[model samples]
Target: AQTVTQSQPEMSVQEAETVTLSCTYDTSESDYYLFWYKQPPSRQMILVIRQEAYKQQNATENRFSVNFQKAAKSFSLKISDSQLGDAAMYFCAYKTILAGGGADGLTFGKGTHLIIQP
Candidate 1:
């Protein structure tokens, strides 16, 4: 079974400061995909960033980026400049790389709670 792991249950960061959320996963397949999703108070899980297993370069979007270590199965998210709006529950997810694999949806980790400090 493929499992995603988020070591940090809670983390706080001051405004404008950077913070990194740790994540890891266990997967036997080589071509799987990894993702970091942010769930705000609205409870909508929004995709922050994603890294394909085959991509050597890390994935990034605006202030959000990921450190993807394929061999170690580590995929951590980095927030360049923290904001109050960034406070939310972050979930690490993974899915098979096949065409219909997404039909079953992604397997998500327990999630990490992010708190923005003034």
Candidate 2:
């Protein structure tokens, strides 16, 4: 079973600063996937970024980057030049199996509430 963990329950960043959210996972499989998702007050889960376990290089987006440590099973998300729009619930998610093949949806962490200061 693969499980994702987000250590910080809450975090805050200034309007134009940067913030990194910590995440770790436990997986026995060498080839799997990790993802970062953002859920706003609207409760919509949006994909922030994704990383394939086999890839040694990290994954990054416009304002997001990941520190993927395959050996340590850690994946952290860094939000740079943060904006008020980035203030939301950030979740670390892992894609794994279940009893059947329907578990491809996602297994998410408790989530970190990101607050942005004006």
Instruction: Using TM-score, give the best candidate's number.
Output: 1
Q: How close is candidate 2 to the true structure, as a TM-score?
A: 0.92
The best candidate by lDDT is: 1
Candidate 2 runs further than 4 Å off = 97-102
What TM-score, computed on C-alpha atoms, does each candidate reach? 0.94, 0.92
lDDT of 2 by residue, 17-112 (tens): 999999998978777789999999987889999999888999999989999999988899999999999989999999864455674767789999
Candidate 1: misplaced stretches above 4 Å?
100-104
lDDT of each: 0.92, 0.89
Lowest summed lDDT window (length 10), candidate 1: 96-105
Tens digit per residue, CA lDDT, model 1, 1-118: 8988899999999999999999999989989788899999877889888899999999999999999999999999999889999999999999887774346479999999999998
Clashes of each: 0, 0
